[model samples]
Target: MSSKMEKFSVLMSVYHSDNPHYLDVALHSIYDDQLVKPDQIIIVADGELLQTQNDIIGKFISHCPNGIAELLQLPYNVGLAAALNTGLEHCRNNLVARMDSDDISSPDRFQKQITFMSTHTEIDVCGSYIDEIDPVTETFISTRKVPLTHNEIIVFARKRSPFSHPSVVFRKNKVISVGGYPPFRKSQDFALWSKMIVNDAKFANISDVLLRMRTGNDMMARRGISHLKYEIKVLGYQRKIGFITTGQFIHVLAIRTFFRILPGNFKKVVYKIIRKCYG
Candidate 1:
């Protein structure tokens, strides 16, 4: 490790349904493939995982240098937000990078983010664009980009998520100071961003893509009515926090609910159009 580089921890949460192969790929990308590796890798097992998943995790622990990998096992499954909060408490470094079990991070992802955070000490949270890929074939789909500067991100957060969750490296203390991730099962990242924004935490996103995110066909299916309910809760919280005005809240909620209720195929098309226009 370079003397100028500050040590950081990689935090990930895995559950029963996560694909073992995908988890293995994600692990290797952040460790073996990275130009700047993390000082510690904290994996929070959200629930009881399959034997195959455990085997994959064991192999990864063996591959890492001694004391680099730590596993925190949960007796039962909790949603992503709570699981991450648990993992956050275990992070040994003040700077922590968030990783998803099914994403492929670019080798230079950490190198670039660490360099940016080291120099831009004012930024508490930094994220980047992500390339969406087909989960089955790993084929390129499209890029999901976010705002690059603090002001732009604050404005962008009014309508959509200003940061890609898995592509972010954030200050641990800043996040905890804002009460960590909110309790929403969905749109928790959006809610967290709103909380941080209201708390005056600085944010930024790199203009370049730093990770390949797996988007399965069920992506649209996952955004059904239940998802919309949590989204509405998040929007309500945003309004309460003064992150968005009542008018903006109603307008965005109407648009989101309309798309959420659309037929699956039609919803996908609508998403593409929206992404092209705003993403």
Candidate 2:
């Protein structure tokens, strides 16, 4: 079916195990992302951790479309992939967009992304640029841009992930056909994109930045190391598709290192200048 004919579910996993205020902030961002009402927004919590999440669901339900927000507490900490799979199963939609419990998204995020998917038929998954937030100040943070086409992004595997996980809005059918996310692991988002790319799945990125990712304490905080690991692994996957000489791979690592030490505020200034000069 065409994306134009699709309804979407914004699936998020909650760990009442997590801090309360951050969760509230996340839901507010989700509601804000939907320019048009979504099919529903479902939250899943660990079963052993149900009561904890029940309190949270009760607190946030009124913030969304009537009958649009709901929660499920799983029997255990089945891992993020498993919890999300459970949410996907219950909330039927032609498209699925991943949302982290602590990030913020722009108000037109879904409207713009879904409309893009509707016209670009060949692309199976798409993502947009994001701003990395400073958790302490709750202020707007550094922006990161990604390449726009499959070929450009495949080359991106030579460095860090070219796309932001939370900024992705994708075709659900393609995800399931590619085997969804792996069970009990980190870099599940990276793995999903890699697997799809290896199988010739199409991709694209919007030129505009659409998400605000809070770092330092969020789930992706292990980025400094975990990303290095995922990059090496992604490089290996790309090599299986073609050739990546040892020299080129090392160069990629050097570039990644340069971006890593870059001061956040400095990077913000640099991006602002770029946006003004070119955008």
Candidate 3:
């Protein structure tokens, strides 16, 4: 690890569904990148991965220096939130960079994020925009952009997720102090962000894209009646934590309900409009 990034760990959670080959690509993108290399890569195995997945992880660990890649295995399949919470407890540094098992980080990602966190000591969490890509061919499909300032992020989080989950690097102590990621089935990150905001944690995101995220075709399948239920539940939690008012919670629920009933194509348009309006 380089001196510039010696204080951070890359935290990722993997499970059975994640593609082994994609995981290989993702790990290489982090380990074989630019001037700053992470001091530790803390990968939490959410559940039992396939033999192939285990082999892929072994291959990567063989190349890393001893103790650089730490794998925390769980006996059963825990959801993302719980898995991440466990990973957080094992992190060796205060600054932890969040990574998805299948997303590719840009060569300058660590350098950019580390520099930003070092200079802006008050910012507890920092994220960046990402390019959505077709996983098989790795072709860019679109971009997911977020607000770059603290106030904008707070406003945007009222309606949608303000930070890309896989592109964020945050202070471990701050996150842990706020109770870490809540154990929500679907909107865990959003829920955690809401809690962090209520705790007065400063947030920021770079305007430039710093990661390539693989989009599953069935990603939209996760957003229907069930997803709306989860969102409403998250909204309720946010209100309970005093992050949002009752009126704001009701307004968000109505908008989300309307979007849930719309056809897939129309929902895409509505989401695009929302992103552009918030962006």
Candidate RMSDs in order: 1.9, 4.7, 2.4
Candidate maximizing lDDT: 1
lDDT by residue (89-162, candidate 2, tens digit) is 77777677778887888888888887887778787888998877777666764567788878998877554466
The TM-score measured for candidate 2 stands at 0.77
- How much RMSD separates candidate 1 from the native structure? 1.9
Model 1 over residues 6-96: C-alpha lDDT tens digits? 8999999999999999999999999999999999999999999999999999999999999999899999999999999999999999999
Per-residue CA lDDT of candidate 3, range 1-279, in tens? 233433799999999999998999998898887468899999899999999989988888888989999789999998999999999999989999999989999999999999888778789999999988888989986788899999999888888899999999999999999999998988899999999998889999998899999983336534778778788789999999998899998898998898888887777777667545664
Give the Cα error of residue 116 in candidate 1, in Å: 0.4
lDDT of each: 0.91, 0.71, 0.88
Backbone collision tally, model 2: 1
Superposition error at 239 for model 3 (Å) = 0.8
Could you tell me the lDDT of residue 42 within candidate 1?
Answer: 98
User: Which prediction has more favorable TM-score, 2 or 3?
Assistant: 3
Give each model's clash number: 0, 1, 0
Compared with the true structure, the alpha-carbon lDDT of candidate 3 equals 0.88
Clashing pairs in 3: none
